[model samples]
Target: MNLGPLEIGLIILAVLLLFGYKKLPDASRSLGRSMRIFKGEMKGMKDDDVRGKEEATTVRGQLAPPAAASPTAGAPDYEAEALAAEARAAEARAAEARARADAARSGVTPADGTR
Candidate 1:
């Protein structure tokens, strides 16, 4: 199904009627920008896929190397990491609470509700 000149004209007319001439330039500019961004993202995805394929081929003969191989990597000690992260988060929450309390006592609103 080919859109001849008449079909194209009708579509253009419909668009003009839907969005007046005054708004056409802004709409067209936005459309063009969106298309360019979409094209760039698609190109990036294609490049990533190609690189992944190349890497897979290169590693086909040998075992893939470990992502991290520190002395502590032997044992999967995720529990320690989780605990450390939790402790940090708890400290942050405590500090925020203290800031809010101080702000309330001083009769001033905290900068971000937690200062």
Candidate 2:
């Protein structure tokens, strides 16, 4: 399957005889252009696939609230949910800090939960 120097030289000679040196540059340039176009199209297809997936995710997120909610109400408010989650996390952190401080003052090891 591997071409040695002799095989490569023979192939080159055949090409030069068939197309001539004058046309070789033009043929190579056209081949290069075709390859570039093919590569560009492949890249474009991949980008389109990624874009399609993102759009589907967005559409699903938009549609999910109405399906999950009762018919009487509108879509769920995700922003408020996110904000409430953040607030809960902040409160937990504050509570942990207070516990550590309390343990330090009472001479308790926080890890052992002793006073």
Candidate 3:
């Protein structure tokens, strides 16, 4: 709840009577000074928070990310692998043909059926 004008006036009157007019000015001045100091401290903290956030963002920006590319970009193609496999198959067939020729020259006939 908030104090209405009546309550506030009563409080002021009480203070005035307790600490007469002579001391009231000094008391109010000190209170104002303290409030200003407190306000300044709060402002400083807010500025520090802003500065910290700015610095963090700058640091994050400095750390560059890897470049983006398509999934098939800068990658080996399977077509090349298929061609290499075909070449290997051809080499295997040639070797098998040479083996058969050597066996025929040595008289190893198919009718032998030797294990």
Winner by TM-score = 2
Model 2 segments beyond 4 Å from truth?
60-115
Runs with alpha carbons beyond 4 Å of true place in candidate 1: 2-6, 59-115
lDDT of 3 at 26: 75
Show how many residue pairs clash in every candidate, following the order shown.
0, 0, 0
* Every model's TM-score: 0.46, 0.52, 0.44
lDDT of 1 by residue, 1-115 (tens): 9999999999999999999999998787657655654565567558656755555434545543455745455764444544565566557656755665566457587686422
* Global lDDT scores for all candidate models: 0.62, 0.63, 0.58
Candidate with top lDDT is: 2
lDDT of 1: 0.62
Q: Summing lDDT over every window of 10 consecutive residues in candidate 3, give the lowest-scoring window.
A: 62-71
Candidate 3 TM-score, true structure as reference: 0.44
lDDT of 3 by residue, 4-112 (tens): 9999999999988999999987777657655654565567558656755554334335622223534466754444544565566557646654554465446564343
Ordered list by lDDT, greatest first: 2, 1, 3
Task: Give the distance in Å from residue 113's predicted Cα in candidate 3 to where it truly belongs.
Answer: 99
